[model samples]
Target: MKTTSTDESSAGGVTPVAPDAATLESEKESMLRQPVAVWATALACVFAFMGIGLVDPILPAIAENLDAGPSQVSLLFTSYFAVTAVMMLVTGAVSSRVGGKRTLLTGLTLIVIFAALAGTSGSVGELVAFRAGWGLGNALFVATALAVIVAVASGGRAVAIILYEAALGLGMACGPLVGAVLGDLNWRGPFFGTAVLMLIALLVLVVKLPSTPVTGERTSFAAPLRALRHGGLFGVSFSALFYNFGFFTVLAYTPFLLDSGEYGIGLVFFGWGSALAVFSVFIAPVFQNRVGAANTTMLTLCGLVAVYVLLGVFHGTPWVVTVLVVVSGALLGVNNTMYTEMAMSVSDNPQPVASAAYNFVRWMGGVIAPFASTELAEKFDPSVPYFTAAAAAVVAVTVMLFTRSAVEVHGPHAV
Candidate 1:
């Protein structure tokens, strides 16, 4: 007679055996073993995230070398993010037409060329123009990368997202260090450095990743805008807008506040970025798991307000300012993760369309805050920008509070 395995039961049996420990462990391991194409895309994501903080340590240097005012120099961020926000509208349209592989290559090529051109610029205006082109490339790459990763990765969308977030956190943590090391030599060094690294990523992606076939109907240019009409998506997008104003204010303005040199500034921000990485990857899940995504978002926004207030009050003390900046990173990390999860789940629209709409709206805050913060410091007081940022955080908290029911119905909690 044949013997039955643990997974099998006799006819008319009343009990079933659970999966054995060895089988469960094998399943867990399979989730981590991604294909080569997934790894290549994830590597590219790291380089892309690094670009966000790559200029932080060099901001003051750029100003001094180019003989530009704080407000004018801040336009570097304004130009970059403004173009990125506008380009978000067209990314899905273009990607659906060209297919993901070609789209990735096109975006990477643009970044390589524009970043190199930015490094060669002698004037602030020239740099700003090149940065705008770079922003457009970034918009294309980022919007498509997620869909590709999820399509290719094993263990489903959740695993792919975790890999993406890990790349983001690691890149963010390292960007300042890379900038400081290069920017210490020359302000243009970081720009050139980015170009070189992205070129390598481009090469790896081209060689290793197979071409992804275009599937489904093409996305419309107006799809993202139309997605925003949904109340849940609209609420999350606008709430993130207010939150991002505070986030970018701190990120773009704090270098000027510190009297420390390039290396010191990089070290301080490294600590900040590391804290952000830790909280985003580890702590955020715990908080969201316990309190739910909506409540966690509100709590983090309140934490940001408190941190910004402390920064404003202790503006004169370098040590205090540095400490608060690092602490603020944890708050930012939590908010970023929660907002992203909420945006993805909060609407009935296609996931890519919802993502594009959310990004387009929130990045507008990034475009505004850097230039506005510098102008405010020039006109009113140095600390006014932080106070303004605090106010923005308050607005975010208020929005979340009012939209709590809708957020719960449509947010990560629903998953």
Candidate 2:
């Protein structure tokens, strides 16, 4: 006798057919078993994002080697992210005109050139300027990467986004390790290493990814800004700005608070990054499946606020602060995945346009936090930045609450 999977004898009639073990396993495995193109783009993405934290362990070395003040050296981040934020507006336009494959190659080429130039710099100003160029390259590549991944990857948007976030987390976790190891030998080594790795990613992409020149209507320069008019997209991006403030506070300011050597600080952030990867890939989805995306976002934001508060309360305690920093990564990973998914689904704009718009607003917090946290620490005290970050997180939570309906998810696994 053949048996069906569902029961139909209930008062309400037919019961919903739940997926069986085989079906469930297939879905789970799909996320892992992507095509060569998806893996290539993801691998390149890892190298691209590594540039963000690549200098974290070597900031002091750069300052000392170049005879520059902390403020000037900090401009490394300021310049990189500032250019990245502003150049986001141009990414969609460029990608639309040149197509995704060409655009990605161009961006990777620029990073290769600038990163190499940065390694050869004789002055802090030169390094900063080269970093700015690198940012321009990053802007093009990073903005287009998510759209490309979503378009090509199997399973669904949910699985694709998880892959992207995993790449982000892995890159972030590994960036500091690379920086610490190479920087311990010489500050220029990290820059050169990033350049070489990016070069390899570029070559692999050229071979593995097919040409995808756009045939659709070209995106305008103002498309990203215009895309922000959608309430859901705008609200999500706005909240992200505040949320990122808290995120960067820990990333930029915590090292100073640790007062550890390069290797020690590198290991701490590595742990943080590893936790971020694991949580984003494995745990965040479970939370989303259990509570839905909207609720999960709110819960994680609250968790972050609490973490920031604890960091402030224990600023003088290195081990506690170190642990909290790693803990924050889990929360950050969840939020990053959720926000990117929402940003893509929230608007009717093209994926690249939506990504460009969201990143534009999102990275402003990156630009502000490093300088703001450091300045606050100098002007007030060590604890003030964490308290301030907590306040910023509160603002994020409040914004999310108010904007909740626009981006709310109904089912377990809904993107």
Worst 10 residues of 1 by lDDT: 9-18
Point out where model 2 deviates above 4 Å: 1-24, 409-415
Q: How do the residues 1-415 of candidate 2 rate in per-residue lDDT, one tens digit apiece?
A: 0011224322222222334566556667998899999999999999998888788888777878899865677778878899999999999999989999998999999999999999999999899899999999999899988888988998756678889999999999999999899989999999999999999999999999988968779999999999999888898899999999998888877877787878988899999888989988888867765665667888999999999999999999999998999999989988888877778766667779999999999999989888888888888888999999999988988888877877653122332
TM-score of each: 0.91, 0.93
Q: List model 1 lDDT by residue over 1-415, tens digit each.
A: 0112334322321121234556435434755798999999999988988888888888999999999988998988899899989888888788788888888888888988999999999999999999999998888888778778867887544456556776777777788889999999999999999999899999999998899777788999999999999888888999999999998898899989985888988988888888887887667766876687889999999889999999888988999999999999888887777887778666667767877898899999999999999999999999999999999999988888877777676565411
**Best-fitting candidate, measured by TM-score?**
2
TM-score of candidate 1 to 2 decimals: 0.91
**Per-candidate clashes, comma-separated:** 0, 0
Listing every candidate in turn, what is its Cα RMSD in Å to the true structure after a full C-alpha superposition?
6.6, 5.5
Candidate-wise lDDT, in order: 0.83, 0.85
**Model 1 backbone overlap count:** 0
Alpha-carbon shift of residue 178 in model 1 (angstroms): 0.7
TM-score of 2: 0.93
